[model samples]
Target: MKTLSKMHGPARERGVVLLFCLIILVVLLAGGVAVMRSMDTSLAGAGNLAFKRDLVNQGELAIAKAMREFNASGALAATGATSNNVAAANYSAVQLATNAQGIPEVLLKKTDLNGPDVLGNTFRPTGTPISGSGGSTVRYVIDRMCNATGTFASIGKSGCVYTPSKTETPGGDQSQLATPGPSVPSPPIYRVSVRVDGPRDTQVFLQASFTKPE
Candidate 1:
């Protein structure tokens, strides 16, 4: 009876050892899985941020290009569409809706604006890049700073915003120059609104109040 009791005790000890090993193994596996999931979440977050930066770059490029074209129009591009056919179609309408703050605001979808005047203009780059922003499409709008839409002449709105550059000229005070001291009219500020649509559901909007002499 003593020998039989000793054998049963040994068997019980072995079973306890086996159970502890299984619990340790399970804990290790759970820890490994948690680490993998954390890494995946971090990677996804980084990817999203990179895509957003790309979208912003695209929007800024479009706005700058549009401003250049606007400044180059020496003779003042005609108001109506088809008359002034630059690289991209030109529109003379203020399509951007503003909030109570009176600042221009719009999401600016590519599908609608890519077509005609009511939506604004599509930004067409002069040359394609070797590698681009994942084939993003950028659209832009240029609004002549005026109170209402239509010919500025008809609305009695002045296109030019004059800010005299008061500087000392070679001849005495610059302001005290001859009566007709070369009527150098300062350029008017135009609203350049640009929106970029990227491949990874990224959208970006940028605006610059550009001014250049005619």
Candidate 2:
């Protein structure tokens, strides 16, 4: 009888040990699952950030392109030239104007503004506003100008200006002026503003100024 009791006691202890081992295994499995889920969430967030950054960059590039086109037109030579041309077709007359100084005054077209009043005045992009795989879109605004001093200025909304050198001798040759007499600095550099919209309500803005080629 004593031997049977001892055997029974050992069997009970073994059963208890087995049960504890099963519980420990279940806890470990749960921890592993939780860790895996956390890693997945982190990866997804990283992907989204990258997507937003790319969209913003694309928007900035679009603004730059528009500024370049503006500089190609000689509209910057004269002050009071409205960047918006409702009469010219596609804004072409305004997009590609050249003054006597051979300066172009092509300013960026605002997305809010309609196309030029006349046909053939507007600048149409072949393939712009590239949408990314992450469901993002980009928009751009470019405002640029070159002043008479050969300095470039880009104002965002207001217009730009260029001033001719003042004649030093009351009536002497204007071209021979030793120094530019007191004169207002040319208008501010043209500015290009870009906006990018991404999935999940993500938005970004980027801006650049138009500069004359070195």
Candidate 3:
């Protein structure tokens, strides 16, 4: 009988085992790479969502701060082109209409935020960081609810539409607890617009219409 060495049995068997091991190694490597990529993608998505939440929170803060200024000293009373405050950051209705389209984005001022050809960022720079504990800067604007923008008094025909503080949408037979009566004094409403910008090209805009008693 021929010897096993002469038949090349050991070498041939060893070669087959090595080939199988190499194939298994390649498969393991591929799986590991796929898992790593999936983890990286998940982390990136989570980070982006967190940044968005931060921007929204900053916007809320802007609205609150602006309201506080109103309550504290009526700081926003005459803050526009019509007012003598040359350093004011607000704009009059006529100014917004003539410069841009007219109503703001929230108020359907235009199709898009960049529309009407001119409704750019006109809020004041308080020098306060927008994120506070994060990145970017925050700025806000307060437009008194009115049709025209010369002064609060100039909104004549399309001026303040009084809805009670607790007013509800006119729908089903819900209790008319907050029903607004014409005899009630028309409380002033303010339109608050805020812009929050952050790193990696993050940007958010928020607007709210609110009223507070004098």
Candidate 4:
């Protein structure tokens, strides 16, 4: 009877050992699956960030185009040219309405000003979308920092943000000059807003402000 009992005891112990091995295997499998899922999520996040950075870098192209348009010999170079809204040039002499975030309402996809007078007239890259290396499209709008659209004299310096540079023979003060000092009209500040559209329906907005000689 003792010998028979010993044989049964060893057999039961073997079965218990096999059950423990299976439990350990199951635990390891679950841990491996969890790790793989975590890795995949991390990879996806990194890819999204990289794509956004690429889109932002591509915004420089729009900014460069706007600068050229505002420089001398460009369509917006003359003082009279900036006195009114030029839909073709995407230029506005008066300040544009902006959203709560300070983004121009004209550049928004859906806004009250989405008519031909505003959103429908934004300037694209030469009337077409300029494709970037990452398949992004760029557009921009320029607005002069003024309350109304008209001649500088009509709007007056108080109505616009103008920076005056003294050109009165260096040391000569305008108050002391015998005659009205040479009219040194400082440049007016212009704001350029750029929008970049990229893959996955991602959109990026960039803005820059500069002064150009009138």
Backbone clash numbers for all candidates listed:
0, 31, 2, 0
TM-score per candidate, in order? Answer: 0.56, 0.47, 0.58, 0.72
10 residues in a row with least lDDT, candidate 2: 86-95
**TM-score leader:** 4
lDDT of 3 at 129: 36
**Residue by residue across 53-132, what tens digits does model 1's lDDT show?**
87887777766556555444622343333123233333334333554544344334335333323235433322221224
**Alpha carbon lDDT at 143, candidate 1:** 53
lDDT per residue, candidate 4, 6-110, as tens digits?
434333344787899999999999999999999999999999888888888898888887788767877887768888877667777777777878788777762
Question: Model 4 scores what on Cα lDDT?
Answer: 0.74
Candidate 4: the clashing residue pairs are none
The numbered model that scores best in lDDT is 4
Sum up the clashes in candidate 1: 0
Comparing 1 and 4 on lDDT, the stronger one: 4
Q: Report the C-alpha lDDT of model 2 over 146-207, residue by residue, as the tens digit.
A: 22222233332123332322333444355666565664333344545455666776767675
Using lDDT as the measure, what is the rank order of every candidate, best first? 4, 3, 1, 2
Q: Could you tell me how far off, in angstroms, the CA of residue 28 lies in candidate 4 after the best superposition?
A: 2.5
Residue 2 Cα positional deviation in candidate 3, in Å, after optimal superposition: 18
Predictions in order: lDDT: 0.53, 0.47, 0.53, 0.74
Give candidate 1's TM-score. Answer: 0.56
